[model samples]
Target: MATSTPYSAPLDNEKFLYKLVIQLLIFCQGSHRLLEPHLLAIGAKLRSGANSQELLSELQAVSKTLVHISKQAKQDVNVGEGDGAALQNNYLLERLDELLNDAEVPLRFQHQTSLLKQRVRANLSEDSYKKVIDSAITLLLNIKDYSVSEQKGIDVFLGDLSDRLDELGQDVEIAGQANREMIDNRENLNTEIHRQVGSLKDSTQAAEELDILKNQTAEYLDRLLEQLLEHKQIEDERQRDAQEKIELMTKKLQELETETETLRVKLKIEHDKALSDSLTGLPNRLAYNNRAEMELKRWKRYRAPLSLIIWDIDFFKRINDTYGHKSGDKTLALVAQLLLNNCRETDFVARYGGEEFVMLMPNTHAFQALEMAENTRKMIQSCGFNSNGENVNLTISCGISDFNESDLHDDVFVRADQALYQSKQNGRNRCTVFAA
Candidate 1:
């Protein structure tokens, strides 16, 4: 006899057809414009059923939602409202993106999925979606490759999520058990109370016969000691059960605390991963943009002076060519640290890009921004960076721009860039200010 293999599921055909359809719906916002024909073909393969109808309806609904999502995405790009609406939209997109891994899934029918992803993008690019999916998948699979402490922290957290669900189940069971126990106790108490009353009544009735009651009362008093001994034994058993529960509770609490410490450590690592540059360990460009925008808003709200200084090392490419790329990287790192050390707590600094640094100076005017820039220049000049026996001091050009009534956050960048160009023309290592 031939053996037939048991069927298992991959994200592709092996999984329920619904998974593929749901993914398409989420990605395209259900737009059938591109994938409608393909969906129809999939429907034809299914024997007529209620499930097929549901799939068809979902696909139709997604098309409508995609239209709305597209409009919203465009609106956010140019919106000046500064409300939480953009953030909310971002979260919605993130939820949808997470559902599909932002279009990272290769549809078994790539022709259909590719067409759908192309048509349904509000701001979703295939490359970006691919990047996010690639990154997350890579991170997930390789997370175990991290240091033991780090991996342990992750294990504890993932375990905690599952544990919480199990705990919820256990709590439900315990609650039901408690309810039953309470009912049983109530019934026992009522029965015991009735039995004791009956005994008292019998004793009273007997007491009416004074001579017989006297002998009976003495006998009943003797039996009371024996009954008390039985009650003591029952009480001891109850105490033991309570003691066991208390010990189990203590162990659970200790495990929870250990999990908490591990989580704190894991969170710190993820935070740095998200906010800092992977290569240089300085703040990344995305962090710089977000921070600068926040600073601009704060300055606008309070009518405070805020200046942005955009600086780039002079002849950076020459250095890279003269020394290897490794030497160039160390120089950049060295310059980043030097600039960082020279800035104040109030000042925000970041590596904007290759050989470029941007700083946000709160409550600072053009003159003050210039002074800070000059100080940064001196710091870099003072320290000779040594990497692989190549020693070099750095010179940089800086452009300063300040916020005014007409300036928006995006414009702040442009103005700063202009000033940086002017500073380069004036002389390297000098600071120049842009006039609105």
Candidate 2:
């Protein structure tokens, strides 16, 4: 029966078992597409009507192959089981957190976004993730609306400012021209009065000398009196016109002053905003540049000891990647506050740019600045940072350089930066002073 099985399955049981095995293989192949290739090979062998032993051997081979594949699938799934999954999730969440941080919004929306970003975590539950995503979407929409409204407001403000400035300029020009014309008219009136007075004196002397000329003198005096009266009327009209023009000019000047005051206030606000860092509320790079230039000038004039310290947050990017950008911002603000609090009132501290800060210490030598920087580093290292209820230890590196007799403004910065690089290249969380 076994030998004849290929040509004719003699027993009904054999034929039934064969049909059952074929159907089972078909069902498994359909269910598990991964096993299709192995199953297809087995199916081909079975269709050739091989003997029982050959079929059994082929079945065992396919079963072994399937088992190996199943193990590999489990391993693949387990690859993201622990820290790997958290890292992957944090990668995406950090990106979202960065977007939230970079968005410009009103204070209210900013607060909302800050809260939302704080909730970002590497190991978020599905529900928590969805909630955060929905909140982010809502915050983004609100920010967009606010931006549109703010842009319109800015446009209107600029238009009003421009119009006021133009009006002020025109008023000043008109006032100046009116003053010039008034001065010229006054001079000409004085000249005409002097000439008329001289002519009247000469007529009086002639009238007293010749009685024959008395009638002519009387007619001339009457004509001179009429001319004097006309001149007086003209002077009165000129005085009225000058008074009116003075009042008009005074009102225009008052308006101009008011407009100029308004523009000054607006410009001051804009200037402050431009020089301030929105993130940490510290002076920005522009402010830093201005301060540095002023300090350099002072150093040159007085030969005062002026030291520059460049501070960089160690592993700042890692903080953002591991925790979130919100945490990174918080860290920056905290560090800024620390630096501000520790520095002298006369010292200038500014946020140079992301994760870096510059400090100008007037009347301080490089050694003194280095000491201060070391203390700051130690303070930062000891300070505890909590993100998502977890403690994150932070550290900072600093480089110090002071102005020398021959050093340019940029030379100090370059030396400090190089020193900072050295501090980083060496073990971080320390301070290094430039040698030269």
Candidate 3:
């Protein structure tokens, strides 16, 4: 150690060190060329330093920067700037898995997704990227088409509802006007009756006056007798007129009563139409809402067990597509009748919407409701529906929920709907009861 002083080394060792440093500088320059855009500052630092410690530090910093860039590139990309903006890689994978598993998705689409998913799993190359983009675009286009179709159906329903409401309003206005006219007629008849009564009373008073005159002044009896005779004639004429008026008023009152009855019938018809589904001839959503409110009040007051069941026709859209809309309508009507037949007198059934029915069972628990739903399901399954001379098997799914303490009307409905979804998920033609 004493022989080799502080900065002194063998000539061979010095040459090897110089060669090694030169080789390191060449390697760093090549790396700078490859990564200059990302590592500008680090490259500059590395190039500006020559001391061993300084060089070692710069190399370490460059390695860390490269590592960080690699990790960041592998993370989720910001797809947009608002809600659901982050395009998580794991989420995409999960969605692909779901698409593959979901039987509802078309087999062709599922097949495409399955192939692409496998390729993506193997290698995220340019080919895989293109495939993913193309598949996503196709799927989105289909979704848009389906959404447009659904919106069209909704628009049509709303238009029909508006028309019905307008008709109902016109009927109500007419009824009100008829009522006002009836009131006026009644008032007029009363006035006429009072006038006739007063006339008869005046005639009687005049007759009594004539009698008094005959008893007090016998000398003017001849004149009084003539006047009395003329008065009698006038009184008879007045009586005839009053009798005619009374008869006319009685006929008018009868007519008014008849008109009133007719109006009552018309209003009842309109009310029924407003609260019922025209196609299925079952109570509609409005009726359901009213009934639910009443039932909720009853449950609150009496602590009665109230159960709700939500039923849906399985593959209803398929029926419409395969047979026709007319067949779909027929199916809905048949199902409604079936439900009505099976339901108890106290149970309220309504058509919630297209292919959906709601049942409100008073004083029934969830288990009883479930049993009833199962029976209904079996009935529908065995109904042996036919369309176009081909046997079309119809089935229904049901969900049941009972009223709980502190439960609102909508809460029960939501739970029932959730259970219905579970039934559909588990398999069609089955019933599920909500536990809570």
What does candidate 1 score in Cα RMSD to the true structure?
29.2
- Please estimate how well model 2 matches the true structure, expressed as its whole-model Cα lDDT: 0.80
Candidate that beats the other on TM-score, 2 or 3, i.e. the better one: 2
Q: Write the per-residue lDDT of candidate 3 for residues 86-147, one digit (tens) a residue.
A: 23553464455334322123323446555654554443444665677577667757755865
Give Cα-based local distance difference scores for all models: 0.67, 0.80, 0.71
Task: State in Å the error of residue 375, model 2.
Answer: 3.4
TM-score of each: 0.56, 0.58, 0.50
Q: Which is superior by lDDT, 1 or 2? A: 2
After superposition, candidate 3 runs with Cα above 4 Å error = 1-217, 220-231
* lDDT tens per residue, model 2, 22-68: 88696787766666776777688787886556677767776887798
Best prediction by lDDT: 2
| Superposition TM-score, candidate 3 onto the true structure | 0.50
Off by over 4 Å in 1: 1-160, 163-165, 168-206, 215-232, 278-280, 382-393
